[model samples]
Target: MAIRNVLQLGDPGLRVVSEPVADPGAPEIAALLTDLQDTLTHWRTTTTYGRGIAAPQIGVPLRVIFLHLEQPWPLINPTIIAHSEEQMVVWDACLSFLCIFCQVWRYQQVDVRYQDLQGAWHTVHAEGDLAELLQHEIDHLDGILALDRMTDIRTMCTREEFEKRYRERSPYAR
Candidate 1:
């Protein structure tokens, strides 16, 4: 398993809706999950951004998502099984979109149906930050960016400005 370059926003791969993993028990699927973990680790260590990644971002058009919450969780072919009427809006950024951030509406509490790494079906309910991040990553599988779902996109910044302001890169903006 190797970490792959995340496709940028303009790439056709980013727009292609991913296909679900045919066999959750397949070896390649497991490897893809590993790579997704790598992608998550890259972002978590290299930036103060996110803790999850979707397959499309890493050049794989599979309906797969790697969640790095308390432990590494692989959500293969996940589907939103249930959603609450309660809505919440949170500032979100996509790895493929780089420095751009947007606010999106998501169910405050969501029950998702997904298969685990061991090919067992699992249902989990998430709220707050993890819920928001999970929903954002799942959107990637559907070829939807946070920008597209953003209600009011007022706060905007280029990669250079964001990096400088967040001390992510060269702190020359000061």
Candidate 2:
């Protein structure tokens, strides 16, 4: 598999809701997973940071997501099982919009149900940064982006500006 080009924010494909993968064991699905990992790895190599990617981000309208949270894994037809009542705000960035960052409010925790590469169902409990990242990627499957999660347009800023003015104090600060 090769690194597929990531669709940009303005791309019509990015706005399309992904369809669920009917056959998780399909060969095409495997290739798509590889392509996703390759793309994510390539991006991380260049930027030094990347956590997750949804199928739609690569112009694939399939309910699939690749996550690299200490361990890399593919999530198929992922659904949020439950979320905490509490919410937190974070400066969110996206590969689709590398030029900007937006302040977004997200659930503090989440329980997600998803399928493994073998097509077996599984669930994961995530909190803090992991919770935020999963929510972001799942939103992509529904044709949602971080900008849409922002309460005010004024809170959005150029990546450079975010770095200069808020990076050190940002919740996502390294």
lDDT of each: 0.78, 0.90
Q: Per-candidate TM vs. native?
A: 0.87, 0.94
What's the lDDT for residue 38 in model 2?
96
lDDT tens string, model 2, 36-154?
Answer: 99999999889855788999999999999998766897999999999999999888989999888988999999999999878899999999888999999999999999999996789
What is the lDDT for 117 in model 2?
77
lDDT by residue for model 1 (20-135), tens: 88789888998888888887787777875657789999888999998776788889988887888999876566788866755578889888889876778888898877677778
Segments in model 1 whose C-alpha atoms lie over 4 Å from true places = 158-174
The reply for model 2, stretches above 4 Å from the true place, is 169-174
**Candidate number of the best lDDT:** 2
TM-score of 1: 0.87
